[model samples]
Target: FRKVVHIEQGGLVKPERDDTEFQHPCFLRGQEQLLENIKRKVTSVSTLKSEDIKIRQDSVTKLLTDVQLMKGKQECMDSKLLAMKHSFSS
Candidate 1:
């Protein structure tokens, strides 16, 4: 997320806020990490380590869920910022 505050003469004017894109590089990196974790989970299962497989799967699920939530929030914020910009520009 990015925040822009407009100020003049050492006083506050207005604050403009924006959120980064959901599909930005940072979000993609999280996806990549989740994929890597899945791969590890598969390898663990293949090695007959059921407990390790379960743990890895749980971790991967949590991470993916987190990423999804963050992306959703970012998109929402972006939309709100766009609306605010439109309103201010009008």
Candidate 2:
């Protein structure tokens, strides 16, 4: 959902900072709710037809691919930061 995407993007922007107490609890609860929703959506498969299963599989696969790409990007950014730090230190 767009709301989840916005929340995730906002979190990434300040990934190194400690969230304020007022914001932390609400953000945590939002994350928990998102996780629960995803779990429920994924784990309730008993009634799905074959076509529905295929659709869900496609969506899950796409999501996994996106996550992998994001992870790679983050790793590259971290490496760049480390390289910059090393250059400054020397």
Name the top lDDT candidate.
2
TM-score to native of every candidate shown: 0.47, 0.47
lDDT of 2 by residue, 1-90 (tens): 223333644755755545443222234543666444442124556777999889989999999999999999999999999999999999
Error in Å for residue 11 of model 2: 47
* Regions of candidate 2 where Cα sits further than 4 Å from its true position: 1-46
Clash counts per candidate, in order, are 0, 0
For model 2, name the residue pairs that clash: none
The TM-score obtained by model 2 is 0.47
| Predicted candidate 1 versus true structure: per-residue lDDT over 1-90, tens digit per residue | 223333432235332443322222233554666444332113443676889778989999999999999999999999999999999999
Q: Which candidate number has the best TM-score?
A: 1
- What value of lDDT does candidate 2 attain over all alpha carbons? 0.67
